[model samples]
Target: MTSAAPTTHIVFPLYPGVTHLDFCGPHQVFARLPGVHLSVASEGGRDIEAEGLVFAGLEDLATITHCNVLCVPGGFGCVEAMERPGFMAAIRRLAGSADYVTSVCTGSLILAAAGLLEGRHAACHWAWRHMLTEFAAIPDEGRVVNDGNIWTGGGVTAGIDFALALVARIAGVGVAQTIQLALEYAPAPPFDSGRPDLAPETVVNGYREKLADVLRDREAAIRRVAAGRANRASQ
Candidate 1:
């Protein structure tokens, strides 16, 4: 008799103001994985509004104790999410037993706040990647960075690439390729301005200017989180 394939439980913890693409892109990829059981949960099992869309019927993250993989998605509410004691505690608990700890975009910041990314290399949005250093995590410019069992994706769309890489690791390159084909994951952007280096100076500067206020706020929040972590460690 043949043995049944073991299930891989993948959990995604959601919060308000989350960027839909950050989780949706990866969710689509992971859903295609064989023997994968995906769960989307929020702090209180309540509905979440993200980028104008409402995600309903979510499981409470506090109720989930274990998972094979934990993928945290990023959004504008990330700084606030990092500050939530319950949210951070749940993250630490889930990551403690997860076979793989991962994040998309600014979600890496949450992992760092949870004390999971220290001494590891991670990827985040180009605008905020430098903040990872504050948490003792080396920020990488790669679209997807894998350091040990920690996987992080750069920005929003990169979540798809990150998920595909993780799928390759969990299953096999052939299986990942098959799924890529099934989804027709091909990219041919009309512009060559995806990265800071590739983007025109004016565009980059304009974007930086536009993000200045939020960036300042995020930095302040990260500093507080880092300081608190340092204090806890010292105590």
Candidate 2:
């Protein structure tokens, strides 16, 4: 008789304002993996409201002692999430023992804020990618980036691709391909404006303008966090 394969525990650390797709896309992919145990956790094991959706009954991040993977999802609340002492502490602790440290979109920023992405290449949403520099992280323009055991995906939709890549890494290309086929993961966007480089200048500018206020607030928050981290390091 053959012994069972070791179970892979994958944990997703969530906070309010998270883009549902950021974690849900990957969650769907990982759920199909054989011998995988998945957990969606929050700082307090409380219900989280995101983009008008409510997620309840979450495990507390502090309660999970160990996991094979630690995947953080990005969202509008990421800056606030990074500022939370308990949340950041839990992230640092779990990442310290995780076989893989990963993030989707601005989630990479959270990892950077946790001091996990220093000097590492990471990926994030285009609008906020530059912010990674504040944390000493090099931002990559790739939809998915892998540096050592740290893997990061670009904006929302990229999480699926990132998950597939991770599945391939953890399981095998064959398994990843099987899952993709099963899910019918073929994507064909109706417009060529998914990326700034491909979109019309006016469209890009308009989107940037719309984001200006939020960007300013996020920038301020990140700077404060970065300064705090620097001060702590010097002490």
Scored against the true structure, residue 9 in model 1 reaches a CA lDDT of 99
| Candidate-wise lDDT, in order | 0.95, 0.96
Count of residue pairs whose backbone atoms collide, per candidate: 0, 0
Which residue pairs come into collision in candidate 2?
none
lDDT of 1 by residue, 151-201 (tens): 999999999999999999999999899989999999999999999999999
How well is each residue in 1-235 modelled by candidate 2, as lDDT tens digits? 9999999999999998899999999999999999999999998898889898999999988899999999999999999999999999999999999999999999999999999999999999999999999999999999999999999999989999999999999999999999999999999989999999999999999999999999999999999999999999999
Question: Candidate 2 local accuracy as lDDT?
Answer: 0.96
Indicate which candidate wins on lDDT.
2
Model 1 C-alpha RMSD to native: 0.8
Each candidate: RMSD to true structure? Answer: 0.8, 0.7
Show the lowest summed lDDT stretch of 10 residues, model 2: 43-52
